[model samples]
Target: MSDSKKADQKKAIVFLCDGTEEMEFTITVDVLRRAKVDVTVVGVNIAKEFALCSRGVKITPDEKFSESLSSGNYDAVVIPGGNGTASILGDHEGAKKLILEFYESKKIVAFICAGTLVAEKAGIPHKHTVTSYPAFKSELEKVYNYSEDRVVVDENVITSRGPGTTFLFALTIVEKLLNVKTVNSLKNEMLTCSSL
Candidate 1:
């Protein structure tokens, strides 16, 4: 693509590992792409060919995590949550490093459900308020100012509750990274409720 063409587009990368929440992963990517964002799916610590989701669904990543980091100039980095996904990514040095890189660069770092755990694990300071899956509230609250809102955007760190809230989470990212006009167009195209 021409530099001008690329400059006209918003790019995002979604990180996935084995046991990622299927809905959160899929919905976020779908919504962002529908908004005309260029979305790349990266597999972290999983086979280059595919990653098995929490429900046993399989997905092929567009690139490996390292490859994405090396070559991608994204507006945002997204993480979709699941029980195992949180545990694995939270402990991954690469994942943590990437989160810190994005955070430091003032780029959008978005997560949903248990994926919020990765923020605390990545050693982000506790100043940013956030929200996450209810089960992780206690742990995350110790670090972030916690909220029960379906979606929380504290500066560039955007977080959300869980699978059911994935669309709103993704839409919020679209609004922040792209524009409200794009988000409004996507909501109509995706047939989402206006209030959402």
Candidate 2:
């Protein structure tokens, strides 16, 4: 990558924990990278080296959660949900801290599936409209205005449903960080529906 190109590239940090939904994590990363975003996958677990997904797929993150938090250059912070992903991330003070930092800094804070609960756990002030897995809609409604849209964006915060909505969630991130032009190009090449 050329120096100028690297300088212009948007960056995102994605958090991954044991039992994370594999498709949510994989599709988000793939879509972001396809849009030329520099994505750093962070393993937020004791293992530090790898995390076993809900489907038994093992993924090695690009960095450890502890080390990745200090960098404020990222354009977005993403969290993917699974069966127990919310429980795991909710208990981690570091995860909460990171989300708060990014959100308060006005950077994009995106979460999908049960991951939406993680943001609520981080103490985001209520009343911002958002969405999540149907199972978590009530819980999130307590803090957010709650939308049924496949992908909801309120200011710099973005939330979506489950694995089925991951592609749209990621494409939304690309739109926010890059442009509609980039997203349109990717959608055409990737053959995704023009839902955006």
Pairs clashing within candidate 2:
none
Q: Which stretches of candidate 1 lie over 4 Å from their true place?
A: 1-3, 67-72
- Ten consecutive residues with minimal summed lDDT in candidate 2? 63-72
- The reply for model 2, stretches above 4 Å from the true place, is 46-48
- After TM-score superposition, what is the CA distance of residue 78 in candidate 2 from its true location, in Å? 0.3
Count backbone overlaps in model 2.
0
Cα lDDT of candidate 1 equals 0.88
